[model samples]
Target: MADSLGIRVFFIKGPASVLQGLRQAKLSADVDVFVDPARLDELLQALRERGWHDRPVDPDSRTFPKHSVTVHHSEWPCCIDVHFRFPGMEKPPRVCFESLWVNTETIALAGQQMRIPARELGVLFLALHALREPLLPACRQELDYLGELARREGLSEGLLGLAGTTDALAAVRPFLEDLLPKTTSFVWPEASVEWRNRVASHEPGSARVLAILHATWRVKPRMLWGALFPPPEVFLGTNIYADMSMAGRLRQHRARWARFLRAMPRLVRDLRGLKSSGD
Candidate 1:
């Protein structure tokens, strides 16, 4: 549908992982499309006209910055995540889109053709996605898999260059440090504060806290309110609250605060270490 509108879009993440032979299709996976930011508003309006509407999002989700807007049709089994900027691609949205589009490749999907990032960029996409939650066991497993794949593909230089282009060299520095140890230490960029904080602190519900700290004055109040009293959708549905009872939710919230407090000393120390190294 987007393609027919002359919108430049390509499927990524789950769908691309399947096509790139990196992973098998999962039953619950949705269609994740990266759209040109310039046309995002137009595509969104078109989607609404075609019976696709923005899905309900929890107040907790609004606390943090959003990279994509989700829309779904009642007739469809899965939602379509329309992304304007992929996380970890800290560079400008259009720049990232153009960089990936340069190496775009076509593959057959359910008879019709579809666009996806090239093998190298596809692997990069997965790597960036994993680094967003580096502490998660599942994400760690995926990173391990991709590391081996990167080695097999001899993607050392290509990955490094793409990381630089996408402003991700700092975030993926640790991953590349071992994978491409042969590369000079001087070339690795310093990690950003956002990357360090997110990767270092993985406790559930901590993001809401960080969101308030990170928000500018203009948005801080909203972030604070959302953090304190997120909707039931967040309290009940999120991993932070395994049980939805009031007591259970309070316990989880306390646990999250404890974890965040514990992680802070290490996280701050790590950031200081990065800065000391000339970050």
Candidate 2:
């Protein structure tokens, strides 16, 4: 559909890796396609016209600078994640896609020709994506897999050039430290607000905390209220409670509140530490 609209689209993340023979065992949770930022709405409308619907989400969650929008159909098991920009890449969305498009090559998948990032870019993005949640067991395994890829393909300075242009050098540095020149050590920069939020936790609570942290003095009270009593849609949109009954959804919200309360102290400490550093 996007192709008919003159939009250039390409796969990314898990599907891209699988299509390029980079990782056979990796499974895609959804179909992730990177589309031209300029035509994102047209592509989204096309999907909607075909019975795909956006996830039930609050307005704040749909704000700009977000990487992707997820749409789902009742009959499909996995959602379609349409991305206009990628997280951890600080370059303008159009510019970043343009840089990456240059390195993309055609591949055959599902009986159709598709474009995916080159092997080197694939390995780099794998590290960048895994490093988002460095402590998770799955993320740890991904980092380990990245090490295997690096060893097999060998490192390249050109990968560093791509990382540099996208301002993701500091984010992917810990994984690729040995790729750096030996004479001068690389210094890590401060982590961005979004990065810290991702690291703090993958919960709406983290977004609430961040909203409070960045809220002005005058709006702090309103933000505090919002944090305490977020819209029910915020909790309803999650897969955990999507199929649950009303009572079950309420229970899930209660459970989330308890977890959020328990995690607040540690989250504060982590965010404070991140204020002065980056991972």
Candidate 3:
């Protein structure tokens, strides 16, 4: 349907797209794809008709942009994460989707022609992991693969140039340096204390609420109130209590309240830990 509608789609960020045919590449549980944002509604409808159902979107998740969705079909039992933008950049890169689309490469996969980021842009896409979470072992492994590809293809200069243009050189530098022969196991570079604090401050849920309260309480006092008492439909859906008798609704509310009370101790502990961490 997307092809019929003239919407461009490209595979990205999973084993098939990033690690295809690499001996060290681990299999990803699901496939990731990016599509034209304007065609999102049409894509969603098409997927639904094909037995894919939408998963709830967590409004506070900072990991993915707002124009992203996950859908699953029972027949395949693997999720398809659809994105209109790349993940985990503190801000959007200077590079844009139009340029990426213009440079995509075609590849044969399972008897179908699929599109992916061209070599230079592909390295940039994988480098996002370093910026997001450089400490993770999986991310380091990906960097290793990227570095090997760059050297083998004589793309070192091109990759560095692209990274510089995208304002991602700072994140890409350490990984490139790791490619140099070394005697030691790669020690994860420590993010500066200020950087760590900033990342933590922007974390979703309660941390975000606190930051908003601190920065704009007088101008938008409603933020705090909304955080504390979000509409039940956000979680329970509009029809949660629709068909229930008064007695049943009352029982459901009581049960929910009991669960909240039971979770209070853990919640308090988490809050204390956050405070201690200076976030």
Which is the leading candidate under lDDT? 1
Q: What TM-score, over all chains together, does every model reach? A: 0.79, 0.86, 0.62
List, residue by residue over 1-279, the lDDT tens digit for candidate 3: 577768888887665544443325566777788887667778888889988977654354322235467787778857888877664322252244565677688888867888887777777777664445554677667667777776787776676555545444544557556553466444443443223433343223434334453444474555555445544433433232243556755665666557566766654665567679765
CA error at residue 26 for candidate 2, angstroms: 3.1
In model 3, which regions exceed 4 Å deviation? 18-23, 61-67, 88-95, 164-215, 218-279
Question: Can you give the lDDT of residue 51 in candidate 3?
Answer: 89
Candidate 2 wrong stretches, greater than 4 Å? 19-21, 61-65, 184-189, 202-204, 240-249, 275-279
RMSD of 1: 4.6
lDDT of 2 by residue, 1-279 (tens): 766788898888776686555565766788888888888899999999999999866545412236888899988899888988777777789888888888788888878888888887887777878887888898888787777667666755766777887777767777777655577566676656666566565543765676567667898887677666666666656762463667876787688889888877777776667576643
Candidate 3 colliding pairs: none
Show where candidate 1 strays beyond 4 Å.
58-63, 215-222, 231-279
Please provide, for model 1 over 104-164, each residue's C-alpha lDDT reduced to its tens digit, 9 standing for 90 to 100: 8898887878888888888888888888887788889888988888888798789888888
**Candidate 3 whole-model C-alpha lDDT, 0 to 1:** 0.59
